[model samples]
Target chain A: MKKNFKLYISLFLTTLKISAFTFGGGFVIVSLMRKEFVQKRKWLTEQEMLNYTALAQSSPGAVAINTSILVGHHIGGFLGSIVTVLAAALPPLVIISIISLFYNLIRENLIVSYILMGMQAGVAAVLCDVIMGLSASVWRESKTFALAVMILTFLSLALLSINIIFVIVACAVAGVIYFGKIGKKGLKNDLS
Target chain B: MIYLELFWAFFQIGLFSIGGGYAALPLIQQQIVNNYGWLTVSEFADLIIIAESTPGPIALNAATFVGTRVAGFAGAVIATIGFIAPSAVIIALLLFLYNRYKNLKYVNDALRGLRPAVVGFIAAAALTILKLTFFSESAATVGLVNIASLIIFTLALIALRKFKIKPIMVLIGSGILGLVIYGGLSLI
Candidate 1:
């Protein structure tokens, strides 16, 4: 732990730079971080990365922050988590604050507005990719019933304008039931 | 009064919206457009447009824009802070717990289950965003044949997938088209 202090600092800095440069949120940043941490530094295995990502997601923090903390703690103990999460979070937090302040005037300007509109279209495209990407993943991993739940959730909230809380509650119940069934079957199979 | 309510509403949005920026959109849209009437759906649409193109996360950008629209500078700060507060507080708490447990099996299992669920949630949110973008209610308000935007979108996707053109380029190029086309159309 102590020997790799320089390596950890470098990793922290690299993650920070990537976070600052990437304009999008967690998913894009996650990809960038994975490239740096996994492919470049050989710090974490792909399986480790996936495990950390899952932990980061379920935990209460921003996925980006959570991931940084996980990597930080894994490498350098408590202090490492602090340093990395700040490094990851600080860039976006500062940039967003500035953007938030001037955004109105920017929104009103014609050239800026048009550019924004174009970006809006681009956002939609990016989201389309996200949908396509996740669509395949969901189909592959999720049980068919679970996929049905997901599709229904999407249609209800996204398309028909149903209340989101209702959607969340419905999904939570479905998840609990699905897991309950799986847990019971696993236990039964073991008994046999 | 209304703006204050809007402020608190967005604060709640920021608080509850977990997973990522996209997750917050449906709730934010509901509160602002349908419930509070702080913005029209088209204005909200425009906000989404502006939010994506600019720097930072979309949810925070929405908070800033909607906050400003509802009130002023102060409103913007309040809303921005409000949106971030929940996650910030939650993160702080998680950091505290993480130090103690470090590694736990059930914690790991729950997280594994959660990953797929989050994928579901994000996919659902993405679908909602697409509807907000393309399948709009009133077609007249959108520019001349949104298919142009759609084409640009499709081309940009292909560029990203096949050619490996960076998203920033797509963003800038499409923005230029928006400027030229909308600017040109406004004149005519």
Candidate 2:
């Protein structure tokens, strides 16, 4: 347990540092996470990492936290998860806490504003690239249907202010229906 | 008990937040601004700005920012812990059961359908961000400079995709571009 605790602490710190420095949100963090968990430590297999990502994306909170907790738990169990969560949360919590104290002082600065605007542009670009890249992956698996849904959904939300939760819930329901239909087809095929 | 409630509230947010942190923004806004009345919309907006500018996940950053706002340092800790608790629990449970269900065919088919929806959700999020950033009808007229900014953003994006450059570097380059434009405008 003691040795496991130390490993958890190390993993937590690794995650914290990665989370702290990697900007442009969750996608950048995914690469950093792969480096740490997959390339360096080999704590998780590629399939496990992909599975964790899927679970993390669906489950909520921050993908960062969910990924950390999931990865940590996989490597070291319950205590590992606890330590990883702390590690993942602490750096940002501490940094943001300090920023909250001095946010007003920084708010009106021209240079800071310029930097943020730049970062925002960069963030927007990165997000677009991610969407495009991920779209190809989606297309590969299911061809035109997934691509069409993706583009359509993007247009709907981009043009109109439709609530996102409605989109996700609809998709999840669609998944259930597709599977149910497939199952019925399979059973009939088996009998026939 | 207050802390527990705070934890639980954030936990629920964490649990239901698909498409990562940004998707949770509306939910957080609803909970903090509408339901709890913990912070004003403007305050929440300010926190979001800071959260975005800072180097962390927006959700955790918001949790910390709003937590501190609500209950100081302890509140920040409570909120952070609350936000992460559910995912940790759920992940562990999933890991334990993953092998048992790994080869199930219906499960695979369901995942296939769900993958497209996830794509839809992400695309939806990207659209929301674009709308938020670009199309503010309340601003009356779009300025020439803003249009220039958009063009520059597009070029920067093309460069990014072509070169596979990191976003931070592009951000710094854009920051320099902004300085040159705005500072030149002031001189003119």
Candidate 3:
């Protein structure tokens, strides 16, 4: 019981600490999470951690949320997933709640609005960087066919205004077919 | 009534938004802005800024903010839970079976196909935000260039790429720049 209690506390506190500065974004938290779980606690091997990162990226919801759940389950069990989920979800809930309390006060302020507007522009550029990085990595990893999939996805979303869910599903289906048949050179580059 | 809707809406967001947080932005924009009318176009953009700057996942922050705006404390609670439900549930299920099927070659190929598309989706979302920020609402609209915002955007991008600044720092810097340029000058 005492060991279980200790494990739970570690799960909760570690996730809380890791998520505390998720300020940069969800993906950024991976490094901090690595430090805590892999380096410090020694819970996960490097390969395990990499697998978790890949799975977290592919899974639904936020990367942080999926990661914490995976790590929690890795350490504990079903109950561990719950604890990790709560741990991952708690800090943001608290912070946003505090901000929400002041939402009216800040929303009414002209300066905050201006700052947010400016930040929106900044956000756009940052997003552009994210896109460039994503495309470059994708190109390096898989080459032309992957680039074709990306372009088609972009065209439908940007020009056709198709629903994003539909776009994603269609792409997944395409992935299954294209890679299933074109298994010549591409098979060596598969992530699994 | 709104609570039920909030739960359903965010649940869909949590379920369908594959890839990760940034990829999720487009779906959240569609639901919150176009479908529900929870926030205006500009307000939704600000939501991204606030969500990006705050600690935690952007999706969690967004659900909490929009929930609180629409329904208050209860709203926040349900929305956040709704947002996290799928990841926990589906991932739990996957964890159970992952050991067996993790090595399947077909699975690898399918995921390979999905990667570029995920990148594409993220790029599209970024472009959508860029259009909203740079131009007016649509292409036909004239001269709503938001020049001051453009300046911050350019500077922040430079600070990020050239200076190797942290994103939080960029956001804080943009906020200050916003205040100095817009507030001190009384532009608005």
Candidate 4:
């Protein structure tokens, strides 16, 4: 019982530290987590960490949060998952809160607005790169259906102004039917 | 009433934002910017800047920032919980399923389908921000271009895509560039 308690605390602290320090995004946090759990602590093997990373990427929500949950579950079960998630989420809550309190001051400052305007340009650029990178990977899949879905989705959202939720649901249904028709064999070859 | 709305808005964002953190941007733009009108387009862009620079996932940071702006500390707490609740519950269920069956073919197929759409969502988001940054104000106003912003956009994009510079460094460098160009222009 004592040992279990210690493990939970350590899990919480490790995740909290990672969440607080990492600045890039989900993938950055995932790499740091791989270092901590798979290499440093030896809590998880490389294969297990890889599987969790893949699972987290494919699942949903925040990849960083999802990875933390899976690693927490592995170390401490359900309770462990809860602890790690709280740890993963708490830092942002605190940091953003402090920033928010001074929101007007920052917004109103000429220098700050200028700086943010420049940052906005950079952000737009970064987002463009993200789109290019992601689309290239999807294109590499070489699935006609996938390419069609990507193009149609962009048209619907950008031109037609369709609700994003509807597009997501429609694509999900289309995927299930298409993949289901292909059955187990196609699934293995296509995805794996 | 506002609290309820905030919770509901973020809850929906959390539930539907499949893929990852970037996937949440379109949803946040829809619900928070378009639907609720809590933030203007410029403010939305600023929020993204803040979220990217801060630690933690972009979705969580955006939620906290928006919530605090909308209500107060309590609002921040509610919004953050709403944003994370779906992931916590879904991940817990997924963990159980993984341990029990060890295979999630259906889920995998669903994700496979969702991947292209996610790319689309991200592209749309980039377009929105790009239009605002390059053309100024709305997309319809194409005549009034912010040449400085366009210059920064081109340089930053090249730095990120070709040179493979870190995003944080690019952001910082652009801020300095903006200050020098825009600030100097203001003086003249």
- The model with the greatest DockQ is 4
Better of 1 and 3 by lDDT: 3
* Root-mean-square deviation per candidate: 5.2, 4.5, 3.6, 3.0
**Which lDDT tens digits does candidate 3 get at residues A81-156?**
7888888888888888888789779888887876776677788877877787788988987798878988998898
lDDT score, candidate 4, position B142: 42
Candidate 4 residue pairs in backbone clash: none
Residue pairs with backbone overlap in model 1: none
Q: Which stretches of candidate 1 lie over 4 Å from their true place?
A: A1-19, A27-52, A68-94, B1-11, B46-55, B68-77, B88-145, B183-188
Ten residues in sequence with the least summed lDDT for candidate 1 chain A: A89-98
Ranking by lDDT: 4, 3, 2, 1
Q: Which predicted model would earn the best TM-score?
A: 4
**Pairs that collide, model 3:** none
TM-scores for the candidates: 0.71, 0.76, 0.90, 0.94
**Higher-lDDT candidate of 1 and 4:** 4
lDDT of 1 by residue, B1-188 (tens): 75567567866775555566566666777778888888876577666665555555666667767776667656766776566556556555655665578654444444434434445556655554555555532222355346556655677688767776666677777778767766776777
Model 3 has an lDDT value of 0.81
Candidate 3 per-residue lDDT, tens place, B1-188, comes to: 99999999899999887777687887888889889999887777778787877888888999998998899878999999999888778776666667768854554666777778877777777887787877743222247776776778899889887887877788888888877877766644
Which model is ahead, 1 or 3, in terms of DockQ?
Answer: 3
C-alpha lDDT values of all predictions:
0.65, 0.68, 0.81, 0.87
Docking class of 3: medium
